[model samples]
Target: MWRTIGGMLGTDLCPNNIWQYFSWCYSFLPDGEIFYTFGLAALCWAAWNCRNRTTFEFKKMRSPFDVIYVACGFITYWAGLLMGEDREAMERGAKMLRGNAANMMRICAAPGGVN
Candidate 1:
């Protein structure tokens, strides 16, 4: 997937189209897209959904951690589809993300830390 065959005679030479870039980058990765890369996708999806909720549903984001928490939930749930070390790794990563977000939330909640 990184390189096309010498069969490309009519196409302009390119590093990769923006659309294919992410696919090529994630393809055949040892870490697998399902864990880390998909986590990014999950986070983005969570943010988009959260934005929609706030805008259309009139929901309020009381803290920035709300997005992170939602993302962690998504990734953690999807990790169940994996097995062995991949699953473990994804869980650990999700746990770390949750922990860090919580700490940041706590700091923001503290006096003079955020507001």
Candidate 2:
């Protein structure tokens, strides 16, 4: 499952390598960055719902695809509510982070500093 998603994203999507997954997302999802962010936010919401269902209702775990489908629905609903300026702001932030990512990585990777 992860291997296929990773292949499509051009990076590893394993739990231990989330930084790599995010890096790939930042670099590759230029046009779709806002949409991707929305999708991920919706996914988090969906996961929380699933968690509550499991803990409180004792429901069986949902399939991964089902979770994703619900997230997509949330994204669609949220996208309808998001203003154009909100999306533009998100795009600007993504571009600014992309522009400075190399410098930030260098600073974090340097010796005698926090890793």
Q: What are the RMSD figures for all models against the true structure? A: 11.3, 14.6
Off by over 4 Å in 1: 1-34, 112-115
Pairs that clash in candidate 2:
none
lDDT (Cα, tens digit) per residue for candidate 1, span 8-113: 1122333345455455435533455555466557767888999999999998998767887888889889889889998888788778677767665666575775
Cα lDDT, all candidates: 0.64, 0.55
Q: Candidate 2: lDDT over CA atoms?
A: 0.55
Which is the leading candidate under lDDT?
Answer: 1
How well does candidate 2 score on lDDT at residue 65?
Answer: 43
Off by over 4 Å in 2: 1-18, 83-115
Number of clashes in every candidate structure? 0, 0
Q: Please give the TM-score that candidate 2 achieves against the real structure.
A: 0.53
47 in model 1: Cα distance from truth in Å? 0.4
TM-score of each: 0.66, 0.53
How much is the lDDT of residue 28 in candidate 1? 31
Error of model 1, residue 24, in angstroms:
16
